[model samples]
Target: MLVLWEIYPWRNVEVKKSVLVVLVVALTLIFPLNVFASVQIQRPVYVEGKRIAFDISPIVEKGTTLVQIRPLYEALGLTLSFDPKTREVKGGNDKYEVVLTLGSDLAKVNGKEHKLELAPRTIKGHTMVPLRFVAESVGNSVYVNTDTKRIFIGVFMTYLKDKYFDMSWGLSKEEVSKINKNDHNELLYENNKFLFYDTEFSLASKKNMVPANKIYSFEGNKLSGAIVKFNSSDDFDEQYSTYTQVIYDLNNLYRTSSIYPYDKYWIEGDSIERAYREVYKDDRMKMYEMAVRSGDLVFICPFDFADTELALFLQNKGTFSKPEYEVSIMYEQNKEFFNQISN
Candidate 1:
């Protein structure tokens, strides 16, 4: 089992709170703890898919990734403001806002309190704050590719922000066919709702997953969803381990812990055999769900926002002895699906 630090923000959450507070989700991560020197930024930071050039450059002091406060805020669409009198910095656009003291670890987001593992400070005439804290606070995703030694931060609310594979969202069949002219495996479903491309998918640039089917689901001849389903004939333990890693990967890239509060499951014993038999079991003693959600903030406030759910799932279709594991990442982009279905 890949051991992890209990540093995830939602890990300490109580079950009594059914709804995961936004503040907690903002701080949730399973980052490896390691200290380092105040060297020049070895890893280049990319915000919203654009590489940011800083005068002083980003520095990693004690394992925390710190960046120049102003550029980082503006990249996230937040206008930066500072109060010299109080040593405070404020940044916001309209819906999202952040206020923090120069030397304090406490931050205020939309009038709610959030704690940073590292405090904001001045380094070589530039103010620096924990990069992960600010990005994840306003519903953005942050990931560091150790292989590439590059930092990727996405300012997103749902589904990678208008990213739908090689094609953009809301494209017609004619538009898609022109963009991706490569020969595909499958053409159409019975009802002509899906188009499949038998290809591999790389999650957060970490692992290359060879999927059984990479599908593009359509609604009214317009692209509505992009899905990748994987199948494995591995044993129960191996399959379960792979599934959890996938979930953790997506958790950082998408907003989930706020809705599901992942700590509730697998807190006591994370081993596959124990978790499968003990916590997740059916009435027939078969198995509980290994599938978890990677939905956006739409899950928290169903009435307010359109729901774009990046649903991640793992299932043991066959028995334990001859287990047939099914792992899938499904994206359902239904703009008004919530409003139409709800009262």
Candidate 2:
């Protein structure tokens, strides 16, 4: 039967077609391995300061901002009730009625007029009030603890701004916490403004955030604040890409742990890159001066300032000059290296 079938030319063609179909399917199942090799992992946002460094990843909760609501009458040992039909909240035996209108940044407390920065709303069938102003009106306090990941509400007196404590450099967590708990009541200031940062978030990895506080708040000539952390996800590769996303949302630089510990770069193997045309400053002193004049924070890798990258690039372009002797000599060497590497 097989020999007879082979005699039919159509049979040979049909058998070959079946074999080709099986091979194609088999290869299709196995061919994705090499194509997936270039896949990358997203980088994580890192918060770094003079005294603190930590990677902000594996976030328990992820949001740019957080808001919490507090009930006033209930905390004061008084009865409270809300009427969904009327959009009214009643407190205590006095029947003090507080009316909150949805979609408007205003409220009426005890039949008198009141206002809010954000409006009240009904969530999960319960009337929710604006957090900040409402709580203040009713004599309660709310605090956001970034380290413990909690929103605290009680008869709290210490405002987040009042906890103007500094994280000292190179101190252990225990030392920093002790200071925070102390009644020192010191007002840390910089650039003629009161410094503000989340202490709990700062002290999460390290027991103490004094150094970080100091760096973040107490700049000699320039001031810096906690803009945001940068990270990549399983969805993307490259730290800069993650940073771009963060900047879009927060409009600030993403802090990282990448430290340029040394000021020198080896000329032999390092890739030569040109200076950014729109540099904010010419040299470290100039950077300091510019920062003072502008009061802006400047980002620097150790090599950009320490090595001859800036000087060499500047000399080749002849756009600016620096006063440092090492810069001029190194620029000469760097210029020679750049020419040699290109050829």
Candidate 3:
């Protein structure tokens, strides 16, 4: 049995109002005396399949492991007794009584003496003991896998993040084959719009996909990213068609970045300039850098402007018909994806 004592502060609030044409209100806050609380209970251990998820949310008991002790204890048929006065525990069977201090690492089995490989400690005032030592000492097998971050007890496997997608987890050979084939569709559209800007990147493992853009990683076999083309400098109506066409493949853009070369002379304060400045502040730089470093095909949006300064900056010939402009450092040719997308 385990017992814990806790104390907490309490605050009281009171509000008073006077009845009149103009009412007066009074509020009083009071601090109450702190009280100590104690409780006694049998030890508990929670067993999940090779993985255990610890709830570290509550400040009172955060990071405390809710253990499952029955299977391990019953396997050895160990009888346990606790002395509340000295906070000591005696367990084992009639054949032996193991004496253990609540907070000490030393234990004596029938007075012969023994050592705890790891001392049992109180977390958030709850006594926690190592499951491995207790189980194995009682003839129950305990296996832990550091590689998979898993623990196995009596054919039960438990692992951290078993219910979540972990990017570092490795894939099996069959999973690798399936991923290489691009058999999943991880992209989803929100608000029925294609040019969304959130990182909801994932693939449905069950979706059928062709092999052109498949990624094989614990992340998933999805398109990691791609260069998309958006040509919209034409007539507004015709440009809309091009925009839709560019966004049609929006579902396939993975880790996408863009390239913009010198084309026409757009004004310094033009929408293109503004868009670029805004995107420069976006912290998704690493994704774009990854795309650029990969040397993937990049999409560009050539700005067509008549501003002389912009013209000189682009080094335009002061002519139309797709005049060649000079790409500036501010407009890195490797990462203009957002600008191209906006265009």
Q: TM-scores, in order shown?
A: 0.41, 0.24, 0.25
lDDT of 1 by residue, 1-343 (tens): 0011121123232332234222211222233473334544545676765677777666666688888987888778888888899998988877788898987889999999988877787776899888888887777666664433556676333334432244445677666656655554444442366565565444453355544566776667877767656655545454455556666655443434234423233333346445455655563223432322211001011100123445554554455445566665556553444343332
Q: Who wins the TM-score comparison?
A: 1
Evaluated against the true structure, the overall lDDT of model 3 is 0.30
lDDT at position 157, candidate 1: 33
Clash count for each candidate, listed in order shown: 0, 14, 18
Which candidate has the highest lDDT of all?
Answer: 1
Per-residue C-alpha lDDT of model 2 across residues 1-343, encoded as one tens digit per residue: 2222232222222111111111111111112232211111121211110111122111111122112123334444446665667655555435444556654556776667875644554333444444435544555444432222223334422211212223322233333334545342232432332232222222222344322122122122222121111111222122222223322321122122123311222222223212221353345444433322231222222111100111110111111232111111010012222232235
Candidate 3 per-residue lDDT, tens place, 1-343, comes to: 0000011000011111112232223223222452222222222222332223343211111222223333334445677666789777666765656566665667676676677754454445444555555554443444332222223444111111211111112234343333323223333221211111112222233143212111221113221111111212323233333332322332131111112221222332256544544755564433222222232212222221110000001122212444322111111111122232224
Looking at model 1, residue 323 earns an lDDT score of: 50
- For candidate 3, the clash count comes to 18
TM-score of structure candidate 2: 0.24
Tell me the lDDT of candidate 1.
Answer: 0.56
TM-score of 1: 0.41
- Model 3's TM-score against the true structure: 0.25
